[model samples]
Target: MRRRKLLAGLAATAAAPLLGSGSVQADEALLGELLVTRLRDAMLGLGTAAAAPSSPEALATDFTRALADFDACRYASLAVRLPRLIRVGHALSTSGGDTEQHTLLAKTYLLATRMLVKMDEQQLGWMAADRAQQLAQSTGDVLAVAESARQLAVLARKAGWHDQALSIALSAADHPDLRGTGRAGAAVRGLLVQSASYTLARRGDRDGMRELTDEAAALAKELGATLLRDHGGGFSPLTVQLHRISAENHADDPRAALDAARAISLKALPSVERRSRALGDIAVTYDRLGRRSDCVRTLLAAERCAPQETHARPATKTLISSLLVSGPTSTELRGLAERSGVLV
Candidate 1:
């Protein structure tokens, strides 16, 4: 009975943070390592393929749930599920499933690529993105191909292959098929240009960045409403504005970043991930402007918005470490650091 009581107490302690708000539910490093291992195993096709879904309809249901998990920032759950998903997807494709299966697999790879990019696992991301491109091409889906190009551009930029990245994005944006799909076409093109703008910003080509951003803004303006497709193009005037914030921040113009950030309300962003990321960008801008308190406050808000994003991203972790050493510390700040596993 004593042992039983002790075990129950230990389980409760382990679960305490998950039951509370604004606390790390698990060790951040352990979570990251698990994500990396799972991602690697998935890409390598190491896991047993989950029993093939009884039908394409059932497979799609699972895929939809996986995408939802990603959108909700449930990274740990997504990581655990992706390897099996990948394996089953590949099996279905090889066993004469259908175009739907191939398209679904392509989208799955794209999703994995996006998550890997966020985790700064660029090398592995490239592999996933490459597979996405191949499968997307086979599906004859212009939008899917364009989305794959966008992911490739992002990966290339991270690799410092700026020229290659710019070429990929602009070429896709200019693809003849992308020009005639009306609002959907325009939104995907805008996403491509938005990607190009960031690559230019990384190259310190402020004028180039601004030019592409303005071009993307024009496309977004033409669309007039947010275009969110299941195969993965998400854009709007507000989305352009959000990209402007990050571009300006990257260009060393925190004032401009702040101006762009100030122009929109968090409620307007479509997803918790986007909203939290906007807050994260704002937090970094505050840090750049030497407003430590504002930085901490914005980060706290971001954590409230998405605890996993706040605690798991390396950029945020670096910012937290900087804040810790920069000046006087507050109890709130220390608590945040501890909860994020930045402090013992």
Candidate 2:
């Protein structure tokens, strides 16, 4: 009876929550890792070619849906869907070779590249960006090529190659695509300028960051509209200011970061990803200020707004883990960390 009772007690203890196997955490971790590996395979040219035939119209529609999820910051869903989409896109690209179909393929990979970058798969993201750039070049569209350069810049920024990113954006700005003085040109110009701004910010060049930001803002006014595309070519005044908030967080004082963030209307952000990112940045600023309660609240808000980003993005996850380790040890903060799968 004593041995049986001891065994029962051990079983009960093993079933305890949080750190226990009852939550099926192994499955979740496997799924996340599988998704990451699939992305790496696709980006690094190791993916298997499936016989799944896809039509251009169908692929275009799927790409549009994926873009919707992307802007909505439904990142986990995107991670599941993007690899298949990229594969099918490449498979179909080899067939008829129509310009419209080719452009659609480029856009598909373009979206994939941007999503991969946000997911913090740097090497895979770099290859995806290059593939998108190559496809854009094949499409013979200068604007598409310019956008590809912008994507390359993003990958470079993430990889800590800030100077390379800055050069790519600036050189792309002078492309003939921007010579027309049209909305497209203004948009591309604004995007490249802002890209340069972010690079400068990451390098701790405050004055350079400000000057390029102002240039991007002027271009936004010249266009007199919002870009709001999946690619950075859709950069606008709000987008520029959003980057300003990010730049402030990186370069200026923590208080200055919050002040710059406050200067803009948070709800006016063009996409859920951008909005959540701004909140995450603010959370980081609060963390730096050692305002534990405010930091937890902001991080919780960000996760509520975009759970996938909170979980999948490197910087946001770092914030959550930082809080988990050193921030206040309370029910609320612990609950937030638990929900994010950060504490465990």
Candidate 3:
């Protein structure tokens, strides 16, 4: 009994600061409490009347701005705005009195699904995505349907349904809506193809992944002159490059990943979230490559790039936690991890 107590004490002591201390925001639920509270009020139908005054066009424009904020990894800001957006958007859907107004419902749901995923509410995310798919299909909005599929692929990936995720993404790529020279068509197809590339890389098919990424890159390059409304400021040449680095990392070839990372021009990634994600992928490569100090530096850069996302994202936090567990105890590493809210 004494020996058992001694071992328990040592184990608890070792894990204490890492798990129980306030050094990390691992369980902060960056979006969780806000979502629950706002959504709960919305669910009770308390907000629909006040939100009823929203026009479909106004809702659409606002949704785009929200998407921009989301893409920039401003989750706290988004969390504050989205509940009201959903309330108003939902009211518009039922009584906006036009096809155009109805279409925003699907778009809004897609955004909601993406946000829910970021909040790690996978089940609610899937429900929102499914709602988007149904609404898109009913309104004959192929582009919205494709967006729904993209979110579905994300949920599948989160659930560890890799092959299924790839299949859903590829199916979206083959959409009849993709057969055009329009910017929207190119952007949607490119984004879907790029998403599939990551799944392919995860499955160890580097060649197949590269083929898809190159295809996306070409499409993005061809449409380089402007953004598309389908997914405004959507998948671009720089976004493809970001995916290429991430795919290489997913394939477990840290050397290749590092090489690809070096090739990307950071300024080209316009949004804070994209830049931070690219940096995080680079950090992952450094971590895998056993360049502990470099990994720590890269992660610090990522946090500086997007503090909200760096703190909220599970993958980023997990990487930091792993570094803390594996790295030598040092002021630089520990201090960075603590500041990033991934370690105590």
Instruction: State the C-alpha lDDT per candidate.
Output: 0.82, 0.71, 0.72
- Listed in order, each prediction's TM-score against the native is 0.89, 0.84, 0.81
Off by over 4 Å in 1: 1-29, 49-52, 229-233
Clashes (backbone N, CA, C under 3 Å), per candidate, total 0, 0, 0
lDDT of 1 by residue, 68-101 (tens): 7777777666655665578788887888879989
**lDDT (10s digit) by residue, model 2, range 179-279:** 77477766887888788888888899988888988888887877766874766625767777777777776776677777778877868887887788789
In what order do the candidates fall by lDDT, top score first? Answer: 1, 3, 2
**What lDDT tens digits, residue by residue, belong to model 3 across residues 192-300?**
8878888888778889988988898898899885354336235777777778888888877888888888888887776776788789899999888899889888887
Task: Report the Cα RMSD per candidate.
Answer: 6.6, 8.9, 9.7
Which is the leading candidate under lDDT?
1
Candidate 1 accuracy as TM-score = 0.89
